[model samples]
Target chain A: MFVTPGYAQETAPAEGELQTEIVHEEGHGEAGFPPFDTSTYPSQLLWLAITFGLFYLFLQKVVLPRIGNILEVRRDRIAHDLDQAARNKEEADAAVAAYEQELADARAKAHGIAQTAQDAAKADAEAERKSVEADLERKLVEAERRIATVREAAMKDVGTIAEETAGAIVEALIDRKPDDAAVAAAVGQVR
Target chain B: MAEDPIHQFQISRLIPIEIGGLDFSFTNSSLFMVATVVTAGAFLYLTTSSRGLVPSRTQSVSEMSYEFVANMLRDATGPQGMRFFPLVFSLFMFILVANMFGMVPYFFTVTSHLIVTFALAMIVMLTLVGYGLKTHGARFFKLFVPHGVPGVLVPLVASIEVISFLSRPISLSVRLFANMLAGHITLKVFAGFVTTLSGLGAFGVIGAVLPLLLTIAITGLEFLVSFLQAYVFAVLTCMYLNDAVHPEH
Candidate 1:
């Protein structure tokens, strides 16, 4: 049957060749169609088998392995990078936490130091006030004592002068001094 | 003389050689097939040669293609389907390159031929059968007998299942071949219209504009189809392999 088809195709196309050329019509009835022609089947099949087999081998051995390796390596590298990034992020977070803790501690210590200085200044002010008040009180008392001594001295002098003036007056008027007791009695009476 | 669109697909013997009554002549199809292999190989090799952790643009493309097929296999057949990565990946890359290469001005599309695509489909089918038998032994037959079928209707269901199973290779191969052939043919026909219409004067030139735009649009779409068809082929291969891995369903 295959042989018959091949022979028939060859003869039929030969007969129709003249008319087909005249019309410039291609594949109108020549062997029906080239793809359907059985004459070329064996050769085409043979070559396809041979070429496909070799191509398959090339792919399996050389191309696929190389591609697989590259892809695998790339995957592994990406995973490794992601893991490293995660670790670095954790380290950065820890550092930030430590820095914040130190900042808080320093602030607390500074606050404590400020509180101590303020208390010291307040105590010093209180001690200075008390000392100043005591000094003022001592000075006031000494001035009062001095005034009393001066008053006593002035009273004694005034008494002596009064006695002398009275005696002078009596001598001028009567040419004689009176007795102390009499004079004292008379002055007392006049008073 | 108008260039023939179908002439792009013709297979002429570049170096005719016969051995033991077999035609082993190296044709344009063979040339492009080798070119596909080399192009795919060089692309993969050069892109991944650096193996940078941070990939270049080409490396990213290479890696994306790898992961795309890898994910497809894993999703369809689970982790156990990874063993067929080489087969599925090679088939995907080969078909993808061949389809895209055909979009160039004068490149031959190897996947457009039934024999080539059928051979690839047969390989996938045979692999499924071989692996299923090897792994599951006699229990692999359970695939044809699906779960939750009525006992009375078991024979009918099983026969349908068997026929569908047998048709997998045909369907898979035909899907790729037909899509490529139809798309290439459509593109060629539109392009021919552009050339033929433009040759006839002012009115014909204006008429050619629509076909020219269509050709451009189709070329862009064909690029998408080129990639998508390869993806479909690989995914189907993975699904078929799932049966080998888990033969119960």
Candidate 2:
């Protein structure tokens, strides 16, 4: 499989006869491709210079500039994208920070208002409790004073009744002028 | 036309002497090779020397070549492969200069010969294998056995992969050598036709005109082929180099 039929046949013709001669004689020589001739050094060098110079000029003048322009455009595009991305990222971060700050500020303001309201409620409650307690104490003192006055008035009436009974008993005893036993019984009954 | 094709391979000597074993015979082929190196060197040096923000014409060319290979390597092997830029760039320039130099009237296309291209291919293959081994150590041998294969088929798959891997140099060298050789040979054949027919006089002259036109067309095509072959060579080198750098693929 490694042996290529075409090349193998071409290499050694039957019985050592040159196969290349037949092919060469078949009008292919005039239109034949000659191998590279290395005989002339100076001419070859001169031509090499000419070719190299031509290509160098082409690259230096035409192709390179076009490619360079493309590269520059690409570089500029990449840089622009990076810059835009950075700007966007910064804007996003700023927005987030601003939101956080606003949230914190709002929280602090709400806390202040709530604290003030709570303090006011506490003070009002304390004042209401003190006034109610003071009113209860005053009512209790006034009731105690009325009870003392009523007790004194009842005591005076009782004392007057006792004196009238004693006077009646004495008149009965003097008018009768009775015996000692009778007087003693009358006095006892009156007492 | 000498019957032996080897005679054509000679380049004229600017300085001639037969020293002992040194045999530093500078021929036309050597001269062109030297000139190509110098020109390539100068071209790169001049273009890349300044490296300004706004590049000069030469600088622009140099930068473009650099970026072209850079982009290609990056695309093929990812950004990690960027470090191999120098090797890929050098290979591209050398093959390109060698190819374009061959397009001249009487210069040797070094790439047309198997030895030159084979050497390049060997280098690429060796680099690939060496890097793979270095990166993965003993496990580099695992590259021959792809993933997800059944245990039973492991041996067959490994053998096939190994065979194909071994054939890398052959394919790489042959691709370049064959293209350059065929294109040059075709050009020569057409030129021969124009010369031989032109000798046939008036009516033959009209017949010869067709070949001349064909030759002109072929010459233009040859120029295109020269560039294409160079591009193919460079691209393939990049691909192989990609495997070297990132052998998992």
Among all candidates shown, the one with the greatest lDDT: 1
DockQ of candidate 1 against the true complex: 0.23
Candidate 2 lDDT, tens digit per residue, A1-191? 21133224333442123322112233322212223222222333444345444544545465445455656866897899999999999999999999999999999999999999999999999999999999998998888888878876765564445444444565576664445555455545654
Q: What's the CA RMSD of model 1 in angstroms?
A: 8.1
lDDT scores in order: 0.84, 0.65
* Candidate topping DockQ: 1
**TM-score (second chain) of model 2:** 0.89
TM-scores of the candidates are: 0.76, 0.57
Error of 2 at A147 (Å): 65
| Model 1 clashing residue pairs (backbone) | none
Question: Model 1, B239: alpha-carbon shift in Å?
Answer: 1.6
Q: Which residue ranges in model 1 land beyond 4 Å of their true spot? A: A1-32, A107-191, B1-5
